[model samples]
Target: MNRQIERWRTWVWVLPAVVLLVVFVYYPIVDNIRLSFFSWSAFSTSPAFVGLDNYTTAATDPVFWHSLWNNVLYAVISLIFQVGLALVLAAVLEEVVHQRLRGILRTIYFIPATISITVAGILFSFVYNPQIGLLNRALGAVGLGSLAQDWLGNPQTAIFGVIGMSQWQSIGYTAVLFVVAIQRIPRELYEAAKVDGAGHVRTFLSVTIPLLREMTTLVVILTMSGAFLVFNEIMVMTAGGPSNSSQVLNTWLYHNAFLTDDMGYASAIGTVIFVITFSISAAQILITRRRRVQW
Candidate 1:
């Protein structure tokens, strides 16, 4: 009887967390999915069911497609810089740099990540301004003054400018994560590699990269998911402007929801975001599990 009562006590302890998840997380998601099937607005007391209409409209919307393409571009760029280059940078810091200098450099690189996204966006805005901006001044000094243009004000460069800022803000933080993973690697492996006549490049490819697979998977997923959901930086810096060239799905959804009061369409956009993130994450998990190497 006492053992059964103890088991019941465990369930009692778990109940609150389960309840919170249902109430705050699961319920909202379910309600949003339900809302996507209706024609609704903030002012609507009764949202009329318009099954699949919002999705149909999304399919025909050119702006929706453009925003999706921007998200795809962001994810690809983030994976390259945040995961690929960050890993290489982390490896160099851990293996080549002097210990004292490594700490200082790591701190310096990570400083931008510690700043609020709004602040970073605002700062980059000034940095990319065509006239009197640091980038333009540096270009002019280098005899490339012809390249200077209003970055955020040009449709051609607006998305790229936002993407560049995102990479600059996030690359260091991703590298720091890689550094932590590198530290956890067994030193014996490196010693063995050295004894086998392996140089830094060879050792990194054969030992460090393979062993850090788990962390790589995690970082890749995080970077890509964040790229797809990007909002604050774009909102602060471009407001999806320069003729919506920098519009990402999240920002587009916000514009539809609050700005235009197209609640149902916004819900559909939210659903699309959820589906894309979930599918990509699931695919990554499956692939990682299949190839996971044990240390």
Candidate 2:
């Protein structure tokens, strides 16, 4: 009787969360998957089951492919700038002897992350403006005027400009995560490294980098997922303009669903994104589990 009561208590505590997840998360996901197989515009009275036609349309769309490639590029850039640079910044900050200075610098770096993405996009758009932008003016002042072109207007540079702004916003957040991970490292290991005459670079490469493997994996997953879902900045700054050169998967999905009124195709894109992200997450879990067992 007591065990039954205890089990009932457990269910009572867990049931609300389960209900919420089913209603908000699982139901929507299942509905989206169902909708992907149907043909429906926003104006349609009812959805018509079209089988794999929506998926076929998405697969053959050249703009979808372009947007997908752009997302891949964003992921690569995020991995390099957000993860790599954050690691370096975290290492430097961790080694700083002055606590006050370190705290100030970290706060400064992280300030940009707290700003709204819409604001950042608008601010960067101004910075990238050709005629009166700070970037062009600075370059001209430094006798590097030739390097300054239409940053957001040009097809070649538009995506990269967006990427640079994203990195500026996110690198600090990534660095903070790395800093926390670095703080958890055992002090004895650092002392031992010092006793063994391992200099800063050698110690970082050997002790720090090796210990940070799990954190790096976490950051990669987060940064890559964010890259795949990037939309606001592109929407605000470029709207996937200049012939869709800066288009990403999320932006393209938005364009199709709302602007073009192709809800079925948008659902298909959403399904594809879910699959890709889910597979990556599952792979990461498996790899982490294996590594844990090996360790």
Candidate 3:
């Protein structure tokens, strides 16, 4: 009887969190999925049941496919720069740099990540501006004037410009995470590598990389999922402009929801985003679990 009462007391403590999740998170997701199956807009009083029409529309939409492709491109670039290169940078900072200098460099690298995404986006916009922008001016100063062009104005370069800004802002944050992971590694392992006559490059490949498997998995998952869900920077930078060339999934969803007032279609896009991110996360976790490091 006493144990039952104690269990009930524990349930009482857990109830608030459970209720909050159901009300705020789970309920909204369910409602959004429900909305995806109905034809509704901001002005609609009566939402008509549309079955799979919205999903079908998204499937057939060329812009939707393009947006998805942009997200894939974003994911690939983020994985390379944010996760892969960040790991190498983190290794260099943690293993090679003096302790005091490492701190300063880490702070310098992470400053961009501390800035607001909107601010960074706007700042990069100026940097990419054609006529008087820093990038073009630098190119001209270096006698590479022919290479200077409108970055965000041209569809060919707009997405890449946004991606470059994202990488610059994010790479340091990921590197810091790797730095922490690298710090957690036992120093004895490095000493062992040294005793075995392993050079820096060999030590990194044999010792650092293997131990970092878990952190690498986590960073990759985060970078990929975040790429698919990107919105603010793209919105502030290009607004998917110069002919819808830079439209990512979230921005496109926002465009349909608020701008076009097509709430149902927006919900459908939201569903797609959820499905994609969930799948990516799940697949990563599953694959990583199989190869997780053993003590």
Supply candidate 1's per-residue lDDT for 76.
96
> Per-residue lDDT for 252 in model 2?
89
lDDT of 3 at 92: 97
Off by over 4 Å in 2: none
lDDT by residue (1-295, candidate 1, tens digit) is 9999999999999999999999998898889999999999999999999999999999999999999999999999999999999999999999999998999999988998999999999999999988868889999999999999998999999999999999999999999999999999999999999999999999999999998988999998999899899999999999999898999999999999999999999999999999999888999999988775422
Tens-digit lDDT track of model 3 for 1-295: 9999999999999999999999999999889999999999998999999999999999999999999999999999999999989999999998899988999999999999999999999899999989779999999999999999999999999999999999999999999999999999999999999999998899999999988888998999899999999999898999998799999999999999999999999999999999999999999998887776334
How does each model score on lDDT?
A: 0.94, 0.92, 0.95
Full-model lDDT, candidate 2: 0.92
**Candidate 2, position 60, lDDT:** 95
TM-score, per-candidate, Cα-based: 0.97, 0.97, 0.96
Query: RMSD for each model, in Å, please?
Result: 1.4, 1.2, 1.4
Sort the candidates on TM-score, descending order. Answer: 1, 2, 3
Segments of candidate 1 deviating more than 4 angstroms: 293-295
Model 2 residue 72 lDDT score: 92
lDDT of 2 at 294: 95
TM-score of candidate 3 to 2 decimals: 0.96
